[model samples]
Target: MAILVLGLALWVGAHLFKRIAPGMRARMTERMGNGSKGIFAIALALSVVLMVISYQRAAFVNVYVPPSWTVHLVDLFMILAIALFGLGSSKSNLRGKLRHPQLSGFALWAGLHLTVNGDLASVVLFGTLFVWAFVEMAVINASEPRPTPYTGGSTVGTIRLLVISLVLYAIITAVHAWLGVWPFPG
Candidate 1:
């Protein structure tokens, strides 16, 4: 629990720093030059390690038994979450319209996972991500009032979106198999 909490704090704190202390982040970036990316990469790597360890430790504690249907819902939501994430990240028609599609995808993914996972670690991890996504989205929306409208839907963009979404879905499915956690249990 300590590891999970600390990891969440580090991950969320790093993200929130930009929103909470924009000036500080700007000053640091200016001081660090391109090294800011290195700092961020290190922070991200550390957060992932902490999260994995925390989640492993948390598996010992059984908080609640989730309903079976929750898994199905999670699976469905996860697909949408992936599609939205790809659309958000890719140079697609959805990008300019949503202003923060990645954040929205994070919210959806975290919220969906929370519904399926009823454990202390799951709650902490998913809840923190959900809250962070909401806060980040709100901050971004406030900072950028008007969204830059997309020009027009492109056939190439649509194809790219579909291909990326399918590839990611396949990769996640493979990862699930490798981890021996069949999200969609037979």
Candidate 2:
């Protein structure tokens, strides 16, 4: 739990650094020059590794048993979450309208997972992500200079986004068994 908490703190803190201390980020970027991205990559990798290890260690503690219905609901939510994430990355009107579709998608994903899994590990992982996403969204909205106009995209782009998201979701679902947490358990 200590490692998990520390990982979450580092991950969330690094992400929120820009929002909390914009000047500090600028200073680091100036000092590191092009190496800032490398430093960020290393931090991200370390956070992920720590999170995974901590989650696995903490999984032995069960906080609450989730209802069976929640599994089905979570599947539906995950589909929507994936679609939102896809659209968020694409050059679609969603980016302009939402201004932070990725963050919204992340929040949706974390929230949905929490609904399905009532455990200490799940709570620590998903809850932290939920909070981070909310803070990130707020920061992004506040940082935007002005409301950008939405630009409509072609039907092809919309279809492509849907297809990509569905494919990615399917791939992840397939690998869930290997991850030892099947999202769809029969």
Candidate 3:
């Protein structure tokens, strides 16, 4: 639980650093030069590792029992979340129309996970991310506004992104057995 909390804090803090403390980030960037990306990547990767390990090891304390219907809702929400996340990077029409699709997708992922799993570990894990996404979106949008709406994306790009997202979703679903937490409520 301690490791999980620490990981969550580090993950959120590292991500929010640039948004919350622009001057500090700039100074770090100046010091690190091109190495900032690698440092951030390492910190993020370690944070995830710590979170996964600690979460799996920690004792589960039931906060509430989720209804059976929420399993179906989780599936539905995961698809939308995956689509938004995967398509956010593509030159698709939806990308142009949406602001902060990736962050919204991540929030959806975390929020939906919380809906189905009402445990202390799950709450700490997903809830932190849920809040971070909103704060990150606000800070980023305020700091760097999109000067122009991307209006040149094609239908083909949209289709490609959806197909890719579906494929990626399928792969992750298949790997759930290895992860030991099947989203399906069987």
Question: lDDT by residue for model 3 over 121-155, one digit each (tens)?
Answer: 99999999999999989888898967676677788
Residue-level lDDT of model 1, residues 119-138, one tens digit each, is: 87888888889998988888
TM-score of each: 0.89, 0.92, 0.94
Better of 2 and 3 by TM-score: 3
lDDT of 2 at 85: 74
Would you list the clashing residue pairs of candidate 3?
A: none
Q: Highest TM-score: give the candidate number.
A: 3
Off by over 4 Å in 3: none
lDDT of 2 by residue, 92-150 (tens): 54556676677888899999989987889889899999989998888877876756555
lDDT of 3 at 145: 67
The global C-alpha lDDT for each of the candidates, from Candidate 1 onward, is: 0.79, 0.82, 0.87
Comparison by lDDT, 2 against 3, better one? 3
Clash pairs for candidate 1: none
Runs of candidate 1 with Cα error greater than 4 angstroms are none
Query: Judged by lDDT, which candidate is best?
Result: 3
Model 1 TM-score, all chains together:
0.89
**What TM-score does structure 2 among the candidates reach?**
0.92
